[model samples]
Target: MSAAQDPGTPPRPHAMLIAQITDPHIGLQPGPATGPLDPTGSLRRALAHVRALQPAVDVLLLTGDLADSGRPQDYAEIATLLADTLPTPADGGPRVLAVPGNHDRRAPARQALAAAMPVAPDAPGDCVCLHVEHGGLHLIGLDTVVPGAAHGALAAEQLAWLQRHLTACAGAPVLIFMHHPPLISGMAAMDACGLLQGRAELGRIVAAHGGVQAIAAGHLHRAIVGQLGGAPVVVAPSSSHQLTLDLRPDAPLALRFEPPMIGLYRWTAADGIACHFSYVEAFGPSHPI
Candidate 1:
């Protein structure tokens, strides 16, 4: 069976399996196995996991935080790793898609993923919002990063662009991906720095759009589910260390060396979209249930 296949989800020959790898946070150098976690190493392990998936995934969605410091060299390193690790088909297919995180620099990220992000004459050269259509589904990448701020917010122009695109989809199944989730996750310190002010406007657009299937995001470093504007919103965990899972109102800011995780989104006309979470790092030998 493919690593992405969930035994519970009976195989559907026509289903699209998309691998979601978020928040790798690769640094200037390779990550170490122990001590403070290394983002690059974690990313390598995640990629390996994706490569091992049965029958191969239709596409890989990288949900942001590609670099730890948004540095030029860091992006260069990421570009190199992606070139080396991403699956390439003899038929020359679309293998990966990404958006920028609050930790990513616009110019550097744009340069790094130039091919995936072609220049639109009407759009800014540095615009990170991207639209892609595959197998009758629409995937939109929304830029939620606030300049020079840890928090995220969608500007008026972004919300407008989103509505225009969603409107054009004409009721096709749409899945939106962004760095910061539009809703609060109850992690006090993190929620305090969550997607700021613009969520309502974005929510309004989503609620009005009937085609949107789900909004997926990354940033909290933990898998979570919530709703924004009546649409299902999913927050994918990091491929590296996770944030401490504290739901208390007074929870302190902290990180934990938890086993990394990734999300697999299985899409079919019959099922719509079904998401399954799987750990990237192996723990022990598998035994038959």
Candidate 2:
């Protein structure tokens, strides 16, 4: 019989819950022909859904593309929304953590969000890298934005810093969160703009350390699963809109009105980690069978 089936086995400990919301694209404005895309409304719904979850999440992880344009006003709007929607730390709200995407201005984002999620002081330049611990789990956020470009990369200095942190973890479970995914998604247009540099080095580092339980990222605007150095990589869907799912090599970039979603990660000592996607829309109440 399995451990779960055996009465002698103790029950697993409570898992740490993390809600991942990504690619809100807060300032995006579509042309007249496409009609209005309510990015802000979608984000509000996402936050409401997270706020209603029972037992509550331990952390709220934003995986980038927070703003459509790198504008200080957009970042400020995001901060205002967070303040209005979520409860304060004193009121039992989960801690917020974030990294920057290509659409973000590093300095503006840092200024707006620093009070909630502070970046590491040792972070080189304007990168928003972070390292924090909760309940023995190590959370690492990497800033993968390439200024004025859609593609992403990791600098050599950042890689060295990451290596030092992973080395210090000493076999503790680690979860790395970033904006761009290192693996290809078969969406040709999106893959063309995916992580362009240092992915191999990142894989090497994860493989060498053997402590990374998983890597969570957001860029593809769809829920995707892949592997890097034998560790699982999960790509979260956008909270505002989604990319067209065409995989043809010549397929052009396109957007669709697919249901917006958020990712939830459950991590326990007995069961490493598992990811689930929750739609942002409400479907009324459920009835018993």
Clashes of each: 2, 0
Q: Over 4 Å off in model 2, which ranges?
A: 1-13
* Winning model by lDDT: 2
Runs with alpha carbons beyond 4 Å of true place in candidate 1 = 1-13, 28-34, 89-94, 119-121
Residue 234 shift from truth in candidate 2, angstroms? 0.5
Give candidate 1's total backbone clashes: 2
lDDT of 2 by residue, 1-289 (tens): 0000112222235788889999998889877644558888888889988888877887789989999997899889889988888896557676788898989888888889885456776777878888877655778889899999999999898998888888877777888999999899999999899999989999999999887988999999999999998799999999988899999999988888899888898988778888888887877787899
Question: On a 0 to 100 scale, what is the lDDT of residue 34 in model 2?
Answer: 47
Which lDDT tens digits does candidate 1 get at residues 165-223? 88877776888989999888889898888898689988889888876778889999998
| List of clashing residue pairs for candidate 2 | none
